[model samples]
Target: MANPKRYTDDCALGPFSTKSQKTLSYIFSPTLWTPLLFLLMAAPPSPSSVSAELRTSGEEAVPTEVIGTLGGFMTLPLNISVGTEIEHVAWNGPQKTLALASPAGAVIILDKSYQSRLSISSQSYSLNISKLTPKDEGLYRAQINRKNSNITIEERFVLHIYEQLQKPRVTVKHTMSESTSCNLTLVCSVERAEKSVLYSWTWVDTHSFKSFESSTLTISWMPCDPDVAYTCTAKNPVSQSTSSPIHAQQFCADLRASRGRTVGETVVGTLGESVTLSLTVPVSRDIEKVVWMFNTSIISKDWREPAIAGPLMKSKEPGKDRVWVSDQDYTLKISQLKMEDTGPYNAYLCLNTPRLTSTQHFTLRVYRRLKKPEITWIPGPSDDSICRVTLMCSVEDSGDDVTYRWTFLQKGAVASQEGSLLNVSWRSSEYHPNFTCTAMNPISNSSWQFLSGNICPGPSRSMKHWIILFLITVVLLCFGFSGWCIWKQKRQCSAPAFNSSQVEAPADLSGQDASSSEERQFIHSVLLCTETPTGGTTTATE
Candidate 1:
């Protein structure tokens, strides 16, 4: 007691610390405390603990809700490895129960009413259930433990049971129009989940077909005809089900009305241009195949014939409406549009129905257009003098409606007259060869505007002689006028001198002397006339 009073605050093991004391207590009570601590550390975490911890997949523990598929998974923190193995998995209630063990492969299944125990290895731990029943529904719990770590996972799955399934319902998804094609889809679904279902598809016709899927039916093509129907039926071993009359009748009426194929729609196009017609046939019965016939001839006939342009015929099936169908829109384009090309045509298709046909009428009119005429020169006069340049105008295209006019241009004057011929005096020097004639008709007119080639003389030889005669006649008239003027002047000079001498002698003498003198003067004048040469030309001396 006296030695304890000397104790220092710096003692190796202080009295205030509980670490060493707690360690000593654990060592002394190993039998009771060791097992409790091990249990505490190895116990599966509670749902609250798992939920409260915020974690990412790689950084924290794996959640129990997300159990890996059939394969084993490695969780985070590799030091704490955990996995499970089981021989079989079974269900006991509305939800299934699962139990598994680690490494040892020991397995046990417990339902509300049944419990089973088994051992399994990793290779044989997975169990597959093909069909699920109401009794299979139960809670599923799997436990895995390794070393000091353990994991427990729970999954809840509900199983549904069905009584019987109704047949699938189908309806037209697209509207019916002559110019357009429509599509249809059938939906087959049951209100309750069923383990096994048998599905079959059939039409109003005698044909039968089937489907592998649950209870859905579909028809891609539907026509506006009124005699075809589509039907579907579904069944199981315990019970058989069919679609309701309301839903069935709706599709039935739609398909039933689609009896004839459309084959092709009415089409119009320009002359010399072609058009393709599409033909559709709606049939209540199954179609073997489609055969096409143009008019009375087979499709193999030559397309060059006019009959190919005619209406085609389609033979109908035994139970369907007559189908007149054409791949072409009842169209025939003429190589050249002619009045005869216009007519009625038939487009026909060969369907299950007997003979069905459609007709289209085409009216073709051809127009006649005027073409320009060709011209050639006719042979006539050639050359300026001895040969005259004569332009012979004629039309290459002679017709009843044609008319002609002639025109001439010379010496700064323009004169036009109607005829096929024109004549002008030839001038060798300074002459213009601008002659032209035009031919016209009520419909068209053409001029020889560019016909001015070489203005050479044509084939005439009489023009030179006619011009020479005209020159000779003018020269003769000029010489005759000069001779007449000289004769008239000599007679005037001789008469004036004789008249003056007679007047002076008559006043001075008696009547005898006057008479003798007048007689002598008259005698001398007569003698002068007598002595003058008869043929000699005379000149007046004044």
Candidate 2:
């Protein structure tokens, strides 16, 4: 009886007073008990008591790929930290296991093929393979695990081992078309590399560049197209090599050749300009060296001629750094050409890679462009009876190859003359003439029409002089007419005006009869007064 409430709490499932459970039915309801039972059964244990979970998947992770050179050593990277506790690690090659290591035990390599070459680092646990070969290229797997755990992390790698790519060799095959054109098939390949190597080509010519991919490249051109140079590149995954630029020209030469050389070439040069020789001898060989000569004399920057021109062949032309020989071909270039540079030039080429010898010979002609011709005339004295004038047509720069032509126009007809001089003569009554001068050279020409005064005295000049006189006379006549008009105006202004209506008779005659003698006398006097020169109107008796 003394501890009834405490006893009832001990008997209840919850620590609540009877007043807290306002509805007794709800306090012991089955719906509340069902949910509480299900929640306890559905949930697992808390984090403090959980265990490590092991995961394994196949081909889920993307593999890392790397390049390796043949006969070179490469290590498979281990991404684990330096402080990572490594209980064990294993490496699997393309076909079998290669290496295995344990922190607590000695490293074991199961594969006999890689036993001598395989190695493992204890600190980083990275596996290194030495003396790599082509057969070693394939997928590799690394298995890594921590201490006291069955969990394993795998890393896959793809090894692409390749040999060192050396300088490639290019072989050329020639084909001819029905016309003058031809085709060249150039095959580029490396001898020391694997079959996985790729090839590409580069073709260079005047003002153009072209490229192609493949071990085989086909090139062709017309007779008018310029010679093109080509080079090839061979590359593998780990190494690259490029061939030397092809130096011979016979494969693309449009001109016929004899003994691998083209002869009888010509090149033109303008005065104060540069000139390059045209020598296209396509060949399938490597250029060793090129020697250029001018007029059977060797051409170099410092040229020396022999004292006595007997049997020894040497260059006599003064090079003075003016000549440049192409490294890729047998062509020669001369800068700032002079008039005396007009001569024959010979080029000798020596090539290897199947061994070849070629030559190129050409002539260079230097010319000065013609300047505009000018016509100047010397007029004779006006008092001379015979009209004679000298016309001279000349140019600033004259050359031996230059020529002159003259065209003369007289009256309504035209005439042509040669030479730079013209002696013109015409009488005073003859027609004046106009003329033109043209200067020409082998390369260019210039013409100038004479625009000066009449070359000789004739009716045209006389007519011009007469026109001047006529204009002067007309001006004088205009001045005389203007003066006469001014004089007439002044005479009118000085004279007096006259009116006849106001004339009257004298007062003495006013009383006289209309027929009186005095009236008649006054009338006569008034008329007489009016006749007076400088007087007011005369008064008369009315």
Give TM-scores for every candidate, taking all chains together and pairing residue i with residue i.
0.23, 0.39
RMSD of each: 24.2, 27.8
lDDT, candidate 2, 86-190, per-residue tens: 778878887777778998657898888887898888876777888998889877777776774434656667777888888999987776676545677889988
Q: How does each model score on lDDT?
A: 0.38, 0.63
Model 2 spans > 4 angstroms off: 1-55, 178-180, 221-227, 252-542
In the range 1-542, model 1's lDDT, one tens digit per residue, is: 00111111221222212432343444337585677678658997555334322121112323222111111221111111133233232222223333333344454543323332222334433333323334443222222222332222222222223444454454335344453233456655445625566665555433544334435554443222222355456665445566543222234324423443333333433333333434344546333233232223222112222221112222234333123233333233333333332223323232344433222222222322224434344434545443243344566645444576655554642333335544433443434546656777544566664233345433344778888887888777666666666676567547746675654454455545335566666645544543456655333221
Q: State the displacement of the C-alpha of residue 7, model 1, in Å, after optimal TM-score superposition.
A: 71
lDDT of 1 at 191: 50
Minimal lDDT window, size 10, model 2: 1-10
